[model samples]
Target: MRDPLSKKVVTIEPSGIRKFFDIVSEMKDAISLGVGEPDFDTPWHIREEGIYSLEKGRTFYTSNSGIKELKIEICRYLNRRFGLYYDYDHEAIVTVGGSEAIDIALRAMLDPEDEVLVPQPSYVSYVPCVVLAGGKPVIIELKEEDEFKLTREGLLNAITDKTKVLVLPFPNNPTGSVMTKEDLAEIVPVLIEKDLFVISDEIYSELTYGRDHVSIAEFPGMRERTIVINGFSKSYAMTGWRLGYAVGPAAIIEQMIKIHQFAIMCAPTTSQYAAIEALKNGDGDVEIMREAYDQRRNYLVKAFHDMGLSCFEPFGAFYVFPSIKSLGMTSDEFATKLLMEEKVAVVPGTAFGSCGEGFLRISYAYSIDNLKIAVERIERFVKKHCE
Candidate 1:
């Protein structure tokens, strides 16, 4: 038989984060700190809304862009939370997940070989998505010295004539780095001068600690050029709901919705109704969960330091990226050894990108008790390996 698969699809590697997660799933008594999902349940009020929607038999598909009320609520949430303003009717589209929004946004914007500047040690999907969308993926390896935040020099160095988009994965996954307004200001000029567009993934915005999360869209002259992607998965503990939305200029959003229309008729009706409740009444719930995560974050950072691991303090997201280079093992080797010896599963940093070697991403979304146990096991594993 003739080969049928697109070489582009064949060349992409599977997600490294999921490899360990799958193994840990089958193992008995294994504690997984690998997945970047919230441990909290969907708040009662949100669940109740979904149930009410079902009870009312509202199982029909919404408009290609999504229901008007949900879109309005999304706009309100973005404006109230981050000072971002988008026209609900024309500038937003509900998606299956933040992942889907990312996929379609790239599809809507890129022509073949259009260069996409992606900072590395970011969420795993950006590079693959760019490739699938027929765009060239240019990686900027973020440095730990800069707290893994993308620097102005780094952005300028990666841009060229072909550069069309920059995937801004702030409050970053794996590294837990966030770009402040000052930090963002440094790069906005470069973006404007280069005339580059941005896909700002702000899924972790509400999970920020210490400082308020700032959006690049908030910068002057950026609203039209930036696509903001966010969802309830991280903040409202609604991962399984598979709901996310993208807000941007209407021209771009209109094109994205065309792709979304044929690819996915709409996001789930139940999830949409539930999300309305989440946005309107779930601020307190988010705060409570954020506080718990903050407590766990503090505990784990201290534990890693006490155990002699040089861990950078991450102020956003629930992950701590700790350098395992001192032990003289590759990130994969260290993670595998730790899992086998301690039965604790944590993602190797290489999963995010090649630059993530010598590190490991440990999530603190688990309870304090679980974190304590995991820390104890990690400490023991480190001691054994170091000896």
Candidate 2:
């Protein structure tokens, strides 16, 4: 009998992060530094609101575009934080998560073989989503010397006549690189000159250490070409709640909503209600979590340097991308051996993209104690292996 499978479904590779996770799960007493999830619980007030929604039987779907209140709150949050305004009615639609928002954006924008300029090492989803949307992903490697920031030259080099979009994953995953206003300003001309649509995944917006998070839309004449994706997941520790939103030009958002309406109908009703509370009263939680993460980041970078591993001191996001090249092993080998020897599970850098191969992404989302233990174990493992 012939196998039942669509070629598209069959061709897609499983996420490299999850594959290593499954392997790590089989080992005992593993201290995982690999996960990107916030270790903190959802803030009490936000949780309470979700509970209140469920109790009030607000379980029914509100609208294909999601609740008006949540969208309004998102608009306010965007304006207050980034000075990027959105017409909540026509320029925004709540999605199940940032993941869904990304999917919808790619599907709605790309025609078959259209090129998407994706900066890497980035979140693993970007290339696959581009492909699934019948678009070609042109991966431009972000260099360590540049703090993994997407360069203006790189953006310019990646664009071609077929280029239709640019997926901006910053503050970047794995790398923890946040582009500054000046940094983004450098790329503005390329976008306008090339007429490329931008998907600005700013999920780590609240986690920056020094400067306030800057959006590309904040640049002159670029708001009309940018889709800003943000959510309560990282900032509010609301990962499991699955709430996010996208804002863009009205025409683009309307097309995206059509895709989302047929595909998801609406985002979770209770999560939307909970997100309203998050937008209104959750700034404190963000500050608290960001402070904790900053402490961990300091500790982890120091520990890596002490252990003789070189790393760029991450300025944003809850991760440290340390070079594994000095260890004389591939990132996969380092992660696997560390898991076996020291019971520490870090993600291999290559999981993000080719540019990540010489590094290891160590998430600092765990407690300080766990971070200490993981670093100590890694030191021992590195010594034994390198010696």
Query: What lDDT score belongs to each candidate, Candidate 1 first?
Result: 0.95, 0.91
lDDT of 1 by residue, 1-387 (tens): 989999999999999999999999999999999998888899999999999999999999889898899999999999898888899999999999999999999999999999999998999999999999999999999999999999999998998999999999999998989999999999999999899999999999999999999999999999999999999899999999999999999999999999999989899999999999999999999999999999999998899899988999999999999999999999999989888889999999999999999999999888888889998899989998889
Model 2's alpha-carbon lDDT is 0.91
Specify the highest-lDDT model's number: 1
Q: List the residue pairs that clash in candidate 1.
A: none
Residue-level error in angstroms, candidate 2, position 183: 0.6
Give the Cα error of residue 129 in candidate 2, in Å.
Answer: 0.2
- Measured with C-alpha atoms, the lDDT of residue 385 in candidate 2 is 82
- Give the TM-score (vs. native) of candidate 2: 0.98
For all predictions, the C-alpha RMSD in Å is: 0.6, 1.0
Clashes of 2: 0
Cα-lDDT of candidate 1: 0.95
